[model samples]
Target: MRNQVLLIIVLLSALLGAPVATTAAEGISISETVLKMPLADDVSMDDAVDSMKLRANTLNFKLVAHLPLYKELEAMDIETNRIEIFQFCDARIANEMVIFNPDFSAYLPCRITLLEDADGKPWLVTLDLGKIIPSANLSPELLEKAKMVRDKIESIMQAGANGEL
Candidate 1:
Protein backbone atom coordinates (compact mmCIF):
# COMPACT_ATOMS: atom_id res chain seq x y z
CA MET A 1 0.00 0.00 0.00
CA ARG A 2 2.76 2.39 0.86
CA ASN A 3 4.57 1.47 -2.31
CA GLN A 4 1.45 2.18 -4.32
CA VAL A 5 1.17 5.64 -2.80
CA LEU A 6 4.81 6.34 -3.49
CA LEU A 7 4.34 5.33 -7.08
CA ILE A 8 1.38 7.68 -7.40
CA ILE A 9 3.37 10.55 -5.95
CA VAL A 10 6.20 9.87 -8.37
CA LEU A 11 3.83 9.79 -11.29
CA LEU A 12 2.30 13.09 -10.21
CA SER A 13 5.70 14.63 -9.79
CA ALA A 14 6.74 13.51 -13.23
CA LEU A 15 3.64 15.03 -14.73
CA LEU A 16 4.08 18.28 -12.85
CA GLY A 17 7.78 18.43 -13.66
CA ALA A 18 8.74 19.34 -10.11
CA PRO A 19 9.41 17.48 -6.90
CA VAL A 20 6.28 16.67 -4.95
CA ALA A 21 6.02 16.41 -1.21
CA THR A 22 5.89 12.88 0.12
CA THR A 23 3.82 11.93 3.13
CA ALA A 24 4.03 8.91 5.35
CA ALA A 25 1.22 6.64 6.26
CA GLU A 26 -1.02 7.19 9.31
CA GLY A 27 -1.41 10.84 8.26
CA ILE A 28 2.07 11.91 9.23
CA SER A 29 2.81 15.41 7.91
CA ILE A 30 6.20 16.43 6.54
CA SER A 31 5.57 20.07 5.73
CA GLU A 32 3.78 23.13 7.04
CA THR A 33 1.94 25.96 5.30
CA VAL A 34 3.25 28.97 7.19
CA LEU A 35 4.76 29.76 10.56
CA LYS A 36 3.64 33.00 12.13
CA MET A 37 5.36 34.99 14.88
CA PRO A 38 3.51 37.94 16.33
CA LEU A 39 5.40 41.21 16.52
CA ALA A 40 5.34 43.47 19.56
CA ASP A 41 3.68 46.87 19.43
CA ASP A 42 6.98 48.68 19.62
CA VAL A 43 8.53 46.79 16.73
CA SER A 44 8.14 48.76 13.51
CA MET A 45 8.57 47.21 10.08
CA ASP A 46 11.90 48.98 9.67
CA ASP A 47 13.02 47.73 13.04
CA ALA A 48 12.00 44.16 12.26
CA VAL A 49 13.75 44.14 8.90
CA ASP A 50 16.88 45.67 10.41
CA SER A 51 16.88 43.09 13.17
CA MET A 52 16.47 40.29 10.64
CA LYS A 53 19.34 41.68 8.58
CA LEU A 54 21.68 41.73 11.58
CA ARG A 55 20.64 38.28 12.71
CA ALA A 56 20.99 36.83 9.22
CA ASN A 57 24.43 38.32 8.93
CA THR A 58 25.45 36.92 12.31
CA LEU A 59 24.20 33.51 11.16
CA ASN A 60 26.25 33.76 7.94
CA PHE A 61 23.27 34.04 5.62
CA LYS A 62 23.85 36.63 2.91
CA LEU A 63 21.16 39.21 2.38
CA VAL A 64 20.18 38.79 -1.23
CA ALA A 65 17.43 41.37 -1.39
CA HIS A 66 14.82 43.07 0.71
CA LEU A 67 11.61 43.62 -1.28
CA PRO A 68 9.52 46.55 -0.23
CA LEU A 69 6.18 45.40 -1.56
CA TYR A 70 4.22 47.95 0.44
CA LYS A 71 6.08 50.83 -1.11
CA GLU A 72 5.82 49.40 -4.58
CA LEU A 73 2.08 49.05 -4.22
CA GLU A 74 1.74 52.46 -2.65
CA ALA A 75 3.58 54.00 -5.56
CA MET A 76 0.92 52.55 -7.81
CA ASP A 77 -1.75 54.28 -5.66
CA ILE A 78 -2.41 51.59 -3.12
CA GLU A 79 -2.63 52.67 0.48
CA THR A 80 -0.17 50.56 2.47
CA ASN A 81 3.13 50.46 4.33
CA ARG A 82 3.06 46.96 5.78
CA ILE A 83 4.28 44.26 3.41
CA GLU A 84 7.95 43.42 3.02
CA ILE A 85 9.99 40.30 2.46
CA PHE A 86 13.54 39.47 3.49
CA GLN A 87 15.48 37.20 1.16
CA PHE A 88 18.58 35.57 2.63
CA CYS A 89 20.72 32.57 1.78
CA ASP A 90 23.85 30.68 2.79
CA ALA A 91 25.67 29.77 -0.39
CA ARG A 92 27.52 26.85 1.16
CA ILE A 93 24.33 25.29 2.43
CA ALA A 94 22.47 26.03 -0.80
CA ASN A 95 25.22 24.58 -2.94
CA GLU A 96 25.25 21.39 -0.90
CA MET A 97 21.49 21.10 -1.23
CA VAL A 98 21.51 21.84 -4.95
CA ILE A 99 24.25 19.33 -5.69
CA PHE A 100 21.97 16.61 -4.40
CA ASN A 101 18.56 17.95 -5.36
CA PRO A 102 18.53 20.69 -7.91
CA ASP A 103 14.80 20.97 -7.36
CA PHE A 104 15.69 22.65 -4.07
CA SER A 105 16.28 25.75 -6.12
CA ALA A 106 12.56 26.33 -5.97
CA TYR A 107 13.09 27.40 -2.37
CA LEU A 108 16.50 28.97 -2.68
CA PRO A 109 17.19 32.24 -0.97
CA CYS A 110 14.70 31.67 1.84
CA ARG A 111 12.16 34.43 2.24
CA ILE A 112 10.56 35.64 5.45
CA THR A 113 7.83 38.21 5.06
CA LEU A 114 6.71 40.92 7.46
CA LEU A 115 3.01 41.68 7.25
CA GLU A 116 0.95 44.18 9.18
CA ASP A 117 -2.69 43.60 9.92
CA ALA A 118 -5.51 46.15 9.97
CA ASP A 119 -5.06 46.69 13.69
CA GLY A 120 -1.51 48.02 13.18
CA LYS A 121 0.08 44.84 14.52
CA PRO A 122 2.90 43.22 12.58
CA TRP A 123 3.63 39.50 12.08
CA LEU A 124 6.38 37.44 10.57
CA VAL A 125 5.40 34.69 8.14
CA THR A 126 7.81 32.14 6.78
CA LEU A 127 7.86 28.69 5.25
CA ASP A 128 8.75 26.02 7.79
CA LEU A 129 12.15 24.88 6.54
CA GLY A 130 12.38 22.40 9.41
CA LYS A 131 9.61 20.44 7.72
CA ILE A 132 10.53 21.11 4.08
CA ILE A 133 14.24 20.27 4.27
CA PRO A 134 13.86 16.97 6.15
CA SER A 135 11.41 15.73 3.55
CA ALA A 136 13.65 16.66 0.63
CA ASN A 137 15.47 13.30 0.56
CA LEU A 138 18.80 15.14 0.85
CA SER A 139 22.15 13.49 1.37
CA PRO A 140 23.87 13.42 4.77
CA GLU A 141 25.91 16.51 4.00
CA LEU A 142 22.96 18.39 2.54
CA LEU A 143 20.80 17.33 5.46
CA GLU A 144 23.30 18.73 7.93
CA LYS A 145 23.42 21.99 6.03
CA ALA A 146 19.64 22.09 5.97
CA LYS A 147 19.48 21.64 9.71
CA MET A 148 21.95 24.44 10.30
CA VAL A 149 20.10 26.73 7.89
CA ARG A 150 16.79 25.99 9.54
CA ASP A 151 18.17 26.73 12.98
CA LYS A 152 19.58 30.03 11.80
CA ILE A 153 16.31 31.02 10.14
CA GLU A 154 14.35 30.29 13.28
CA SER A 155 16.76 32.27 15.39
CA ILE A 156 16.51 35.26 13.07
CA MET A 157 12.75 35.22 13.17
CA GLN A 158 12.70 34.77 16.94
CA ALA A 159 14.89 37.81 17.39
CA GLY A 160 12.62 39.79 15.09
CA ALA A 161 9.54 38.73 17.00
CA ASN A 162 11.00 39.73 20.34
CA GLY A 163 12.15 43.07 18.91
CA GLU A 164 15.76 42.17 19.69
CA LEU A 165 18.82 43.05 17.69
Candidate 2:
Protein backbone atom coordinates (compact mmCIF):
# COMPACT_ATOMS: atom_id res chain seq x y z
CA MET A 1 0.00 0.00 0.00
CA ARG A 2 2.80 2.40 0.81
CA ASN A 3 4.61 1.56 -2.41
CA GLN A 4 1.43 2.06 -4.39
CA VAL A 5 0.99 5.49 -2.88
CA LEU A 6 4.55 6.43 -3.74
CA LEU A 7 4.04 5.22 -7.30
CA ILE A 8 0.92 7.30 -7.64
CA ILE A 9 2.74 10.35 -6.33
CA VAL A 10 5.58 9.84 -8.77
CA LEU A 11 3.20 9.34 -11.67
CA LEU A 12 1.27 12.45 -10.74
CA SER A 13 4.43 14.46 -10.60
CA ALA A 14 5.43 13.27 -14.05
CA LEU A 15 2.02 13.89 -15.57
CA LEU A 16 1.64 17.31 -14.00
CA GLY A 17 5.18 18.39 -14.88
CA ALA A 18 5.92 19.11 -11.26
CA PRO A 19 9.49 19.43 -10.10
CA VAL A 20 10.78 16.37 -8.31
CA ALA A 21 10.76 16.67 -4.56
CA THR A 22 12.34 14.40 -2.01
CA THR A 23 10.40 12.56 0.63
CA ALA A 24 11.81 13.89 3.87
CA ALA A 25 11.96 10.61 5.70
CA GLU A 26 13.26 8.45 2.85
CA GLY A 27 15.44 11.08 1.20
CA ILE A 28 14.23 9.81 -2.16
CA SER A 29 13.02 12.08 -4.92
CA ILE A 30 10.89 11.25 -7.92
CA SER A 31 13.89 11.91 -10.15
CA GLU A 32 15.94 9.35 -8.25
CA THR A 33 13.21 6.78 -8.72
CA VAL A 34 12.96 7.14 -12.47
CA LEU A 35 16.05 7.96 -14.46
CA LYS A 36 15.45 8.77 -18.11
CA MET A 37 17.99 9.50 -20.82
CA PRO A 38 17.19 10.76 -24.27
CA LEU A 39 18.89 8.99 -27.12
CA ALA A 40 20.92 10.99 -29.66
CA ASP A 41 19.00 11.76 -32.82
CA ASP A 42 21.67 10.15 -35.00
CA VAL A 43 21.62 6.89 -33.11
CA SER A 44 19.56 4.04 -34.50
CA MET A 45 17.74 1.78 -32.05
CA ASP A 46 19.79 -1.20 -33.20
CA ASP A 47 23.03 0.68 -32.66
CA ALA A 48 21.88 1.83 -29.26
CA VAL A 49 21.04 -1.71 -28.20
CA ASP A 50 24.38 -2.95 -29.48
CA SER A 51 26.22 -0.27 -27.60
CA MET A 52 24.38 -1.14 -24.38
CA LYS A 53 25.21 -4.82 -24.76
CA LEU A 54 28.86 -4.06 -25.43
CA ARG A 55 29.08 -1.75 -22.45
CA ALA A 56 27.45 -4.31 -20.17
CA ASN A 57 29.89 -6.98 -21.34
CA THR A 58 32.82 -4.67 -20.73
CA LEU A 59 31.57 -4.09 -17.22
CA ASN A 60 31.20 -7.84 -16.61
CA PHE A 61 27.45 -7.65 -16.37
CA LYS A 62 25.55 -10.37 -18.18
CA LEU A 63 22.66 -9.56 -20.49
CA VAL A 64 20.09 -11.88 -19.02
CA ALA A 65 17.11 -11.14 -21.23
CA HIS A 66 15.66 -8.88 -23.87
CA LEU A 67 11.91 -8.30 -23.85
CA PRO A 68 10.42 -6.70 -26.96
CA LEU A 69 7.17 -5.54 -25.42
CA TYR A 70 6.06 -3.64 -28.48
CA LYS A 71 6.32 -6.78 -30.55
CA GLU A 72 4.17 -8.61 -28.05
CA LEU A 73 1.63 -5.83 -28.07
CA GLU A 74 1.59 -5.86 -31.84
CA ALA A 75 0.89 -9.57 -31.83
CA MET A 76 -2.17 -8.78 -29.74
CA ASP A 77 -3.25 -6.21 -32.37
CA ILE A 78 -2.51 -3.33 -30.06
CA GLU A 79 -0.98 -0.17 -31.46
CA THR A 80 1.98 1.26 -29.60
CA ASN A 81 5.39 2.76 -30.10
CA ARG A 82 8.51 0.62 -29.93
CA ILE A 83 9.24 -0.55 -26.40
CA GLU A 84 11.91 -2.97 -25.29
CA ILE A 85 13.42 -3.94 -21.97
CA PHE A 86 16.87 -5.35 -21.33
CA GLN A 87 17.78 -7.17 -18.15
CA PHE A 88 21.32 -7.37 -16.89
CA CYS A 89 22.95 -8.87 -13.83
CA ASP A 90 26.17 -9.43 -12.01
CA ALA A 91 25.43 -12.84 -10.50
CA ARG A 92 27.86 -12.64 -7.60
CA ILE A 93 26.62 -9.26 -6.46
CA ALA A 94 23.01 -10.26 -6.96
CA ASN A 95 23.48 -13.37 -4.87
CA GLU A 96 25.03 -11.36 -2.10
CA MET A 97 22.25 -8.81 -2.18
CA VAL A 98 19.63 -11.51 -1.95
CA ILE A 99 21.47 -13.17 0.93
CA PHE A 100 21.63 -9.89 2.74
CA ASN A 101 17.91 -9.42 2.47
CA PRO A 102 15.62 -11.81 0.66
CA ASP A 103 13.39 -8.93 -0.28
CA PHE A 104 16.21 -7.54 -2.37
CA SER A 105 15.75 -10.37 -4.84
CA ALA A 106 12.81 -8.47 -6.21
CA TYR A 107 15.34 -5.96 -7.58
CA LEU A 108 17.78 -8.48 -8.96
CA PRO A 109 18.70 -8.60 -12.63
CA CYS A 110 18.32 -4.86 -13.12
CA ARG A 111 16.42 -3.70 -16.17
CA ILE A 112 16.63 -0.80 -18.60
CA THR A 113 13.91 0.10 -21.05
CA LEU A 114 14.22 1.51 -24.54
CA LEU A 115 11.17 3.17 -25.92
CA GLU A 116 9.84 5.86 -28.25
CA ASP A 117 7.63 8.52 -26.75
CA ALA A 118 4.61 10.16 -28.40
CA ASP A 119 6.97 12.49 -30.32
CA GLY A 120 8.97 9.51 -31.60
CA LYS A 121 12.01 10.51 -29.59
CA PRO A 122 13.93 7.52 -28.27
CA TRP A 123 14.71 7.16 -24.59
CA LEU A 124 16.50 4.88 -22.16
CA VAL A 125 14.88 4.54 -18.76
CA THR A 126 15.70 2.68 -15.57
CA LEU A 127 15.09 2.80 -11.85
CA ASP A 128 17.80 4.73 -10.06
CA LEU A 129 19.73 2.56 -7.61
CA GLY A 130 19.87 5.55 -5.30
CA LYS A 131 16.21 4.98 -4.50
CA ILE A 132 17.11 1.79 -2.66
CA ILE A 133 20.83 1.94 -1.89
CA PRO A 134 20.65 4.89 0.46
CA SER A 135 17.93 3.22 2.48
CA ALA A 136 19.21 -0.33 2.44
CA ASN A 137 21.55 0.09 5.45
CA LEU A 138 24.15 -2.02 3.68
CA SER A 139 27.57 -2.90 5.05
CA PRO A 140 30.62 -1.24 3.56
CA GLU A 141 31.49 -4.04 1.15
CA LEU A 142 27.90 -4.60 0.08
CA LEU A 143 27.39 -0.88 -0.34
CA GLU A 144 30.43 -0.67 -2.58
CA LYS A 145 29.17 -3.56 -4.70
CA ALA A 146 25.76 -1.95 -5.00
CA LYS A 147 27.28 1.36 -6.01
CA MET A 148 29.43 -0.37 -8.62
CA VAL A 149 26.31 -1.96 -10.05
CA ARG A 150 24.61 1.41 -10.20
CA ASP A 151 27.61 3.05 -11.90
CA LYS A 152 27.88 0.27 -14.46
CA ILE A 153 24.19 0.56 -15.28
CA GLU A 154 24.54 4.30 -15.72
CA SER A 155 27.51 3.73 -18.02
CA ILE A 156 25.41 1.30 -20.06
CA MET A 157 22.60 3.81 -20.34
CA GLN A 158 25.03 6.53 -21.48
CA ALA A 159 26.61 4.23 -24.02
CA GLY A 160 23.19 3.39 -25.42
CA ALA A 161 22.10 7.00 -25.59
CA ASN A 162 25.33 8.04 -27.29
CA GLY A 163 25.57 4.90 -29.46
CA GLU A 164 29.06 4.38 -28.07
CA LEU A 165 30.39 1.06 -26.90
Candidate 3:
Protein backbone atom coordinates (compact mmCIF):
# COMPACT_ATOMS: atom_id res chain seq x y z
CA MET A 1 0.00 0.00 0.00
CA ARG A 2 2.79 2.40 0.93
CA ASN A 3 4.65 1.57 -2.24
CA GLN A 4 1.50 2.21 -4.24
CA VAL A 5 1.10 5.68 -2.71
CA LEU A 6 4.76 6.49 -3.34
CA LEU A 7 4.37 5.39 -6.94
CA ILE A 8 1.31 7.55 -7.36
CA ILE A 9 3.11 10.60 -6.00
CA VAL A 10 6.04 10.00 -8.31
CA LEU A 11 3.77 9.43 -11.27
CA LEU A 12 1.85 12.59 -10.56
CA SER A 13 5.05 14.57 -10.22
CA ALA A 14 6.27 13.25 -13.53
CA LEU A 15 2.97 13.92 -15.26
CA LEU A 16 2.94 17.45 -13.91
CA GLY A 17 6.66 18.01 -14.48
CA ALA A 18 7.14 18.69 -10.81
CA PRO A 19 10.82 18.87 -9.95
CA VAL A 20 12.16 17.53 -6.68
CA ALA A 21 13.78 20.90 -6.25
CA THR A 22 12.48 24.23 -7.51
CA THR A 23 13.58 27.89 -7.61
CA ALA A 24 10.57 29.96 -8.53
CA ALA A 25 10.04 33.43 -7.07
CA GLU A 26 6.27 33.08 -6.63
CA GLY A 27 6.31 30.30 -4.03
CA ILE A 28 9.74 29.20 -2.91
CA SER A 29 11.83 30.13 0.10
CA ILE A 30 8.70 30.30 2.24
CA SER A 31 10.53 29.77 5.51
CA GLU A 32 12.81 32.71 4.88
CA THR A 33 9.85 34.75 3.75
CA VAL A 34 7.84 33.95 6.87
CA LEU A 35 10.80 34.88 9.03
CA LYS A 36 10.95 38.34 7.56
CA MET A 37 7.36 39.34 8.27
CA PRO A 38 6.67 41.12 11.52
CA LEU A 39 5.00 39.14 14.31
CA ALA A 40 1.61 40.71 14.71
CA ASP A 41 -1.71 39.35 15.84
CA ASP A 42 -3.22 40.93 12.74
CA VAL A 43 -1.44 41.39 9.44
CA SER A 44 -2.56 42.38 5.95
CA MET A 45 -1.99 40.74 2.55
CA ASP A 46 -0.07 43.67 1.21
CA ASP A 47 2.18 43.55 4.26
CA ALA A 48 2.91 39.89 3.70
CA VAL A 49 3.73 40.42 0.02
CA ASP A 50 5.87 43.44 0.78
CA SER A 51 7.78 41.45 3.34
CA MET A 52 8.26 38.65 0.84
CA LYS A 53 9.57 41.11 -1.73
CA LEU A 54 11.90 42.78 0.73
CA ARG A 55 13.42 39.60 2.13
CA ALA A 56 13.52 37.63 -1.10
CA ASN A 57 17.30 38.00 -1.09
CA THR A 58 17.91 36.19 2.21
CA LEU A 59 15.91 33.01 1.65
CA ASN A 60 17.58 29.63 1.04
CA PHE A 61 14.38 27.61 1.56
CA LYS A 62 13.04 25.47 -1.28
CA LEU A 63 9.85 23.58 -2.15
CA VAL A 64 8.06 22.13 -5.14
CA ALA A 65 5.24 24.43 -6.16
CA HIS A 66 1.93 22.60 -5.87
CA LEU A 67 -0.36 24.99 -7.73
CA PRO A 68 -4.03 24.09 -7.60
CA LEU A 69 -3.97 23.07 -3.95
CA TYR A 70 -1.82 26.03 -3.01
CA LYS A 71 -4.24 28.39 -4.67
CA GLU A 72 -7.13 26.70 -2.91
CA LEU A 73 -5.68 27.51 0.49
CA GLU A 74 -6.03 31.19 -0.42
CA ALA A 75 -9.80 30.81 -0.42
CA MET A 76 -9.69 29.82 3.24
CA ASP A 77 -8.77 33.26 4.52
CA ILE A 78 -7.43 36.64 3.34
CA GLU A 79 -5.71 38.17 6.37
CA THR A 80 -3.00 35.54 6.45
CA ASN A 81 -0.08 35.92 8.83
CA ARG A 82 2.73 33.43 9.32
CA ILE A 83 1.97 31.72 12.59
CA GLU A 84 5.41 30.03 12.73
CA ILE A 85 8.15 28.10 10.91
CA PHE A 86 9.55 24.89 12.38
CA GLN A 87 12.96 23.80 11.08
CA PHE A 88 12.74 20.06 11.68
CA CYS A 89 16.52 20.04 11.37
CA ASP A 90 17.11 22.28 14.35
CA ALA A 91 14.17 20.89 16.34
CA ARG A 92 15.44 17.33 16.04
CA ILE A 93 18.96 18.40 16.85
CA ALA A 94 17.68 19.95 20.07
CA ASN A 95 15.51 16.91 20.94
CA GLU A 96 12.58 19.18 21.67
CA MET A 97 9.60 16.84 21.11
CA VAL A 98 8.32 13.36 20.29
CA ILE A 99 9.14 12.28 16.71
CA PHE A 100 10.30 9.46 14.48
CA ASN A 101 13.41 9.72 12.26
CA PRO A 102 14.86 6.76 10.40
CA ASP A 103 17.97 8.00 8.57
CA PHE A 104 18.61 10.53 11.34
CA SER A 105 18.96 13.28 8.76
CA ALA A 106 18.72 15.80 11.58
CA TYR A 107 15.16 16.69 10.59
CA LEU A 108 11.85 15.58 9.16
CA PRO A 109 9.88 16.47 6.06
CA CYS A 110 8.25 19.89 6.02
CA ARG A 111 4.82 21.03 4.90
CA ILE A 112 4.02 24.68 4.21
CA THR A 113 0.50 26.00 3.94
CA LEU A 114 -0.86 29.46 3.42
CA LEU A 115 -3.76 30.99 5.38
CA GLU A 116 -5.95 33.46 3.58
CA ASP A 117 -9.43 34.95 3.71
CA ALA A 118 -11.79 36.34 1.07
CA ASP A 119 -9.95 39.63 1.09
CA GLY A 120 -6.91 37.97 -0.51
CA LYS A 121 -4.52 38.51 2.40
CA PRO A 122 -2.14 35.62 3.05
CA TRP A 123 -0.33 34.15 6.00
CA LEU A 124 2.46 31.67 5.39
CA VAL A 125 1.97 28.71 7.72
CA THR A 126 4.83 26.27 8.19
CA LEU A 127 5.18 22.98 10.08
CA ASP A 128 7.80 20.30 10.55
CA LEU A 129 5.86 17.12 11.30
CA GLY A 130 9.09 15.43 12.43
CA LYS A 131 8.82 12.32 10.33
CA ILE A 132 5.58 11.23 11.94
CA ILE A 133 4.45 9.74 8.66
CA PRO A 134 5.87 6.16 8.89
CA SER A 135 9.38 5.08 7.75
CA ALA A 136 10.56 8.19 9.49
CA ASN A 137 13.72 7.96 11.62
CA LEU A 138 13.32 10.87 13.98
CA SER A 139 13.39 11.34 17.73
CA PRO A 140 10.00 11.41 19.38
CA GLU A 141 10.86 14.69 21.04
CA LEU A 142 10.58 16.70 17.87
CA LEU A 143 7.16 15.36 17.05
CA GLU A 144 5.61 17.00 20.07
CA LYS A 145 7.08 20.32 19.13
CA ALA A 146 5.70 19.92 15.65
CA LYS A 147 2.27 19.26 17.12
CA MET A 148 2.57 22.29 19.30
CA VAL A 149 3.22 24.42 16.27
CA ARG A 150 0.29 22.89 14.44
CA ASP A 151 -2.05 23.40 17.38
CA LYS A 152 -0.91 26.97 17.71
CA ILE A 153 -1.95 27.63 14.14
CA GLU A 154 -5.28 25.99 14.74
CA SER A 155 -5.94 28.22 17.70
CA ILE A 156 -4.88 31.32 15.82
CA MET A 157 -7.00 30.45 12.85
CA GLN A 158 -10.01 29.73 15.02
CA ALA A 159 -9.78 33.16 16.51
CA GLY A 160 -9.01 34.91 13.25
CA ALA A 161 -11.61 33.02 11.29
CA ASN A 162 -14.27 34.07 13.75
CA GLY A 163 -13.28 37.73 13.41
CA GLU A 164 -12.37 37.77 17.06
CA LEU A 165 -9.96 40.66 17.01
**Candidate 2, position 130, lDDT:** 68
Looking at model 2, residue 33 earns an lDDT score of: 79
Ranking by TM-score: 2, 1, 3
Candidate that would win on lDDT: 2
Q: Judge candidate 2 against the unseen true structure and give its global Cα lDDT, from 0 to 1.
A: 0.84
Those runs of model 3 whose alpha carbons end farther than 4 Å from true positions after fitting are 1-42, 52-56, 62-111, 117-123, 130-135, 138-165
The TM-score values for the models, in the order shown, are 0.77, 0.84, 0.27
lDDT scores of the candidates, listed in order: 0.72, 0.84, 0.36
Q: Over the stretch 1-43, how does candidate 2's per-residue lDDT look in tens digits? A: 5665676566444333346666589666776577789999899
Candidate 2 residue 149 Cα shift, in angstroms, is 0.1
Model 1 misplaced stretches (Cα beyond 4 Å) = 1-31
Which scores higher on lDDT, 1 or 2? Answer: 2
RMSD of each: 7.8, 3.8, 13.3
Compared with the true structure, what per-residue lDDT tens digits does model 3 show for residues 108-131?
333333344234344444332322
Worst 10 residues of 2 by lDDT: 10-19
Tell me the TM-score of model 1: 0.77
lDDT of 1 by residue, 60-141 (tens): 8898988787888889998874787788898877777777767677677887878776666688877677666657787786
**Clash tally, candidates in order:** 0, 0, 22
- List of clashing residue pairs for candidate 1: none
